[model samples]
Target: MSIAPARIDEQTIRALPKAEVHVHLEGTFSLIDLLTLAKENGVALPGPAATLFDISTHTDFETPEVTTGGGTGTGSAGLSGFLRFLDWQCGLVRTPEQAARVAYAFAARQSASGVRYSDVIVNPTHWNAWRGRDLALMDALSAGFDEAEQDGLCRVGIAYSLLRGQTAADAEDAVARLADASLRRVVALSVDGDEKTTGRTGEKFQNAFAIAASAGLHRTVHAGESSGPEGVWDAIDLLQAERIDHGVRAIEDDALIARLIADGVSLGVCPRSNITLGIYDGWASHPLPRLLAAGVRVTLNTDDPAPMGTSLEADWAVAADQFGFSHDDMVGFARRSLEASFADDDLKRDLLTELEAVVTASTAAEVTA
Candidate 1:
């Protein structure tokens, strides 16, 4: 039997098959993984080990003080600051084995959150240790993910990313190497970083994205977050982006919102990340529900779950608890993520079938209860 979308139970939302298309592998570091990797690599902690990754410094969710941003371009406050943190923590990897372990752990975490498939972003710029060995890096990550897939963990594809701070030459060089690498795990060519710090970059990297497209890699861009709606326009028009990461700022331009609806481009949105980074005031002010109501394809995600202390389910809870979204609205968001993923059609179909059955059972349980 089919399930109705009226019930807003926690069990059904937790059980629904999910797809995370915007998560960063650099940001998936759990406290245990951090310690294990630190010990293995002899990386010193910048502060007290126990509270090094605390959310208090990163967010003002419960406090009365209005903490807008985190750090500077070189520090840890705004989008620029957060990108630097990603670079710092991601540098702990000293070998292919370490890279594999990170990828394995990423898939396992996603599986724990009911994510059946994921497209994880890994910017080579962040991994200083893996410098000159990106091909081997992708291979290592793919090997780990392959092992996880064998064990029924979340099936993963890598969205190889270039930091926005890189030059046009850097973009060209990265794409050329990826085109020649023949890595099966590399699914898309993505560009992410602090756009506000870099200014307009679409015109500069247009050729690079074209090369990636020619090489059969999908295109995704991080825009409409650090910058304004103009950045998103550049992503779609110049970069030919198939999907956008953190395109929440599109709400600023009604024309852009209509364009997104017309072009059918899905956005991978991280609501909590926005709040932590000082983009939005709080959950109530987030643009997620409005974006959905406007007929825009919005996919729920945890942008940097570990550092932000959030999960896919936690983001969905924002829609339910904060916005009073019905179960149907929440399910629609989950389904959009699955549909937006770069995963194979067969896998997506299987995941959708699983989702249907779980939702049906959960709905029935809720009805009887």
Candidate 2:
């Protein structure tokens, strides 16, 4: 008789303390939620909401320049096409009430998935409701986060993301507004979008990031996903990014890999999202294992959980099945995420302690079994 391996269960994955640092708020809404929003706001519902969220339908999302010949460009479809979808999804929210609902729900979902902490990124420009009113949007979003924290769901902080195509002047203005807002729940500043389509480099926004850093704000940048190793270099050398979201392409350059390891920078790797976005063919081809072996601090995340049809639990399972990460390795990934977060030291310590206890208990149970 053949022996079968035990299957990973929710109980097993949920028992581990997880932290997410690269999720996007716009991409979190479900088809049902979008439909509800449309009905409530009197906005015409888009047809086949299911197709909108399906990555298979948008195979052209990743442009040929980056996906083939290892060329360097935004890895996704041209700006007009991808942005059309992104903007359509983002346009669903026309009021603070909708924003708050999404934020609170996201926290609850993450809590149930064993994510103890997260730093959710949202690009304010995408929302017409937040046009020329960044503070209002921040306040509304923060209120939602506050409720979630009080309810003991999960601790979440907002990372205000700058769109990639924004001018230097626009970047400075946004950062200044962020500093002035000084929202308690807002923890970091980030830049996200298609780097290849925008033709913008990290150097373009160095001064804006500098201003944010001077304000004691944490920084992360989207790099090496759609672009190449040089994009990662610019993020580290020019923008002084503390973390690189979807930096799988960093494996292309030995010097960049060494630098990331030496500097203790974290790479928030999203496995499913990379494949869905055409950055990689599959998890096996992803740079995560290489990055890990090269001593880079790697943390698994769900970049666009809903759109990519992934959750923290799902990502963790994939990492274990594909990467062959042991239980201890999963725990290490969680621990590093908490450490890399913008969360306070006390929270980090508490979460770390809880994770240690989980490991101990799991080990004891295994021994007994």
Candidate 3:
């Protein structure tokens, strides 16, 4: 006979101390902050400030494009609409002050959602061109990181991204900048941008990855997000990445799955982003559960909170409601993320112990209740 389904309460889910292993820092800018920064920077947006964050209208997932005359541009329709929203984001945050504000707001939001630590991916390429000040962008980013950390809301880490379409020299420069920033303990070096723009395999990014690795920075790549499992392999073999972002397609390759598990490489999984982008039909069909069952270490995150209409808590809720992940399973995911994180040994151990206590205590309390 079939067994009864497990019961998951929202309180238990929310009470689980969690950590975000992948998130785009700029992508986390709340609608209110975005509009405020836009107004201050004199950038013209399509609608009133209030409408920018309106979940109902904005949630109608459409493809993103550069709009003129208040009309959406034609493009690959999907969660990319949210990515298009980010294209317009540069104009709004053109100063160091704005960047710090974005960081603060993002940390506050994550803390409220039960996140104890977060690794925020920041694309300096966008900010460098937008600010055009020749100032130390990495220094400015460190300032933001410091402010977020000082808030005591969460332990914050930064990942610098190299754009895929950039020239080899440009990629080298991005890596050099990241290497210099690594002196201050930025977490990892990431490669992002349009996969098609760089031919998916990203031959030019190798030198950048090499430089980052030489500087003792961990490496991750936005692989298998737009391409297939082969893209994930290229990132592993070609770039020597220590982790992968949106590696859902890895399930398609038995050899790759075995290699990933054997090597202990982690996959930063974003469930809602997958659903919004049509990578998976829904949470239940998402490969995350399968990946986890197969012994692949996976961590959940909100790729773009505003555009994707999700938060850390909401993503966890989906894992419960759709994937049937128990509260224990969700806590296990968080603990694994801390262990697999790019954080230093001391911090990782400390956070792991804290999370274990939280999980153990919460589980006992649930049993008593």
Candidate 4:
């Protein structure tokens, strides 16, 4: 009789070294944190703190447009709902101290989840309360990350998020914000938001991205999520994004898949995020397996951990269980994450070494058993 393989569990998944490159800092806040911040800032709540904190209801992201100020149109319907919730959370932090606290908490939480290093995406424009104080806000957020590093929780880097659907002039102003010396912690410039609502692509912000490239900032743009493979191509050809967020849709086009493989571009794939937003019906239907088999560099991430109800480890466990990944395959996923990160060489080297040793020890023990 043939023997069945052993199962992978959460414990094993959590023990592996991992990194999250596509997560948004604004979405990391816990419900309790949101309540506290709202109370501290005197921001009025839309409903009972307890009721709004219930993310169980918020899981249905396919609902109609719920907010007025953000954007409009068809494709924007899905992600715009999440963005409105994000705007509410961002609006709660009215002070520099609050921003610092939120940042510190985010690092600590991810560290506890087994993330050794993270590139957190922060879009200043989302924080309505911090208008005209972006420099101070960046400095405060950096201070929080610095304190977390000093305590050996997790090393964190910032990726300034550029909102989509803005005018060329607005894009120029967005790039100018990163020129501040106090925002030295920023290592990359990223674009996100509803591609469908904006009815635009990477070409719209090429000049702004060119400025970021001139300033030595790495690029990662969201594409092929709500739109299609054309968005991914525009990001690669026009913005020259080093990494593409949610590029799983590239599987739809064979030529695009060839280009992604040839160029070694990494895709930050969030399986749960896709399912939750109605992009894919469920985990088994996700294109992760095809993307991997096609030789494209892919890494699992929680686009918004707290709100999306996922973590790096949870994503790994799901991948292992759903896709039949072995222990070695899981390790490869972790390794791919570090390789795809925008972290400095020194930090990446250290994290990769630590990851390799952990995987070796664990696999050896499994063999001995």
| Higher-TM-score candidate of 1 and 2 | 2
Q: Model 2 over residues 47-109: C-alpha lDDT tens digits?
A: 456576654355332111211111112544533444444556566776888888888988998
Count of steric clashes across candidates, in order: 3, 5, 1, 0
Judging by lDDT, tell me the better candidate of 1 and 2: 1
Instruction: Identify the leading candidate in terms of lDDT.
Output: 1
- Distance from true location, Cα of 277 in model 3, Å: 1.1
Measured by TM-score, the strongest candidate is 4
List TM-score per model, in order.
0.90, 0.91, 0.88, 0.92
| Clashing residue pairs for model 3 | 64-81
Candidate 1 lDDT, 1-369, residue by residue in tens: 976445355555677897999988888899888788888877776556677676334422212122112211112344543554565677777788988899999999998888999999987766777777888889988999999999989999999988676779978998999998868989999987667667888999999999999999999998898788999999999999999999999999999999999999999988888888778889888898899889999998888898778788877876677787888777787788899999988988988888778778878997999
**Minimal lDDT window, size 10, model 2:** 63-72
Lowest-lDDT window of 10 residues in candidate 3? 66-75
- Model 4: per-residue Cα lDDT over 97-142, one tens digit each: 8888899999998888788889898877778777767767878899
Residue 331, model 1: Cα distance from true site in angstroms = 1.3
Candidate 3, residues 1-369, lDDT tens digits: the string is: 999567665566567676787888757777788768767966666555667744334433222333211011112343244444555674456677776677778778888887778777876544533443323555666677678777687777777776665678877876786676554737788877655434564577888889988998889888876667888898998898889887888999999999899888899888787776566687667888889889898988777777666777877776777777776787887787787677778888888888888877866987999
Model 4 segments more than 4 A misplaced: 53-78, 180-182
Ranking by lDDT: 1, 4, 2, 3
